[model samples]
Target: LGGGMTNAVLALAVISWPKYARLARSQALTVRQQPYIEAARLSGCSDTEIIFRHLLPSVLSPLLVMSALDLGTMLMELAGLSFLGLGAQPPAAEWGSMMSSSRSMLQTAPWVILAPGAAIFVTVSLFNLLGDSLRDQLDPKFNPK
Candidate 1:
């Protein structure tokens, strides 16, 4: 069921979308209970305005941060599927598949395996750090200083 980038992307999106949905739902629910929302309602803000102006902003920040964090995980998952021959067929170059195909060379030419592995490591680490930085910057409660 895999040979192209689109297939991998669709698979990952299908698998990961529920997490974001749940997060949005929870954030909305939490924000709904805040005193400011109550005050907005008391001051005659319509439901649509309350949602657009207040709830959306409150919920979107966490979602963006979560999406940033999920990028690395999704990439790893895509690579894993490719390595297992379930994603990104031979024509498509994927780090996991590259490493998988080079497994036999581990003893004779370890660099072949090491190169892709190192790339995956660095890429994943950078994504994770990006997510953390986003969280720190976006979330009001987090103060890195």
Candidate 2:
């Protein structure tokens, strides 16, 4: 179970990082054209120094928002995999496994399946809402008048 979660996180990080890196690079490229960046360069600052010190901070807000959104998605994927028995195995009382095992009883005792399923639904929804809120708050382009 632990290994599965770790692998999921690792995979998500690896897959998501390139997109964030591209956004960061685009932001950095734009920031680099700013007068301050030119001034820094004129003052003998290295490219690495300008990127880390100037450009990175400017793009952190959107990256953080995106990361929060990714977390909820990763959780859903993990739960789906676990439910299929490809993740957590026997003896573990994971929500997915519980839901999976209750599949046969779903017609008789629908609550058994509904309970865990609802929990997963609510948790994922809350995270997604929170991420969207964060994105709205952090993104200058979405600023209210």
Candidate 3:
């Protein structure tokens, strides 16, 4: 389970990095176009100085929201891998492990599988809802014109 969780997190970080970089770059580009950035540039601010001192703070909110959204996805992927026996070992009491063990008994005691499956479903859903809410609140694009 630990290994699976680690792998999932690492994979997500790697795969999602480009998007994050793009967001940062886009934000930086926008910030750079602002008058304050122009003033700082005219005052002889370096590129790194402009980015770290000026642009970073402007994009912090969306960056934080995106990070929170990523957490839920990483959890779901870890649970999925664990459910497939590629994750948690036996007797660990993880939701995925429980579902895996209950597969054969699915017809006999559907509750056993349903319970854990439902838990995972609800957790994932809640995280997704939270992420959507955060995005809506943090990003101007989602706002009604």
Candidate 4:
């Protein structure tokens, strides 16, 4: 069903689609200019074959890194939307809603506010760290010990 968090999900996807496409297209353009791709074309390889066999593999790493980063951003955005009453409905246990619902109790009970806030903080931090690690791993100059 296209209810609940679905609208936020769709909205974010639509909003971010252009950025993803531009990144992929730039990567593809760079990859295409590599000598190997030119050689593949000279060898009578079809466009589809060149794309699937060569370009996709080359572009996938950066896309994955971007996706990992975006995952965290998307989580935060969903939570923000939920807080604004545009995402998850009442009585649902979404972190943003939890924070929203707990706002009035902020002074009386600090733990209520702390819980969802901490969850969002930890999750976003972990994802950003994971993305950074992935980027470092993908870099040829990066050495892991």
lDDT scores of the candidates, listed in order: 0.89, 0.79, 0.78, 0.89
**Top candidate when judged by TM-score against the true structure:** 1
lDDT of 4 by residue, 9-34 (tens): 88889999898899899999999899
lDDT computed for candidate 1:
0.89
Stretches off by above 4 angstroms in model 1 are: 2-4
Number of clashing pairs per prediction, in order = 0, 0, 0, 0
Q: Find the 10 residues in a row with the least total lDDT in model 1.
A: 1-10
lDDT of 3 by residue, 36-73 (tens): 99999999999899878988887886787877777777
lDDT of 2 by residue, 1-88 (tens): 2446456456656776788888778877787788998998999999899878877777788778877887778778777877877656
> lDDT per residue, candidate 1, 1-145, as tens digits?
4456678788788878998999999999999999999999999999999999999999999999998888898888988888887777777789988988999999999999999889988998999999999998889988765
Candidate 2 TM-score, true structure as reference: 0.79
Model 3 off-target regions past 4 Å?
1-4, 43-49, 140-145
The deviation in Å at residue 38 for candidate 1 is 1.3
Q: Residue 18's C-alpha lDDT in candidate 4?
A: 91
Once model 2 is optimally superposed onto the true structure by TM-score, how far is the C-alpha of residue 131 displaced, in angstroms?
A: 1.3
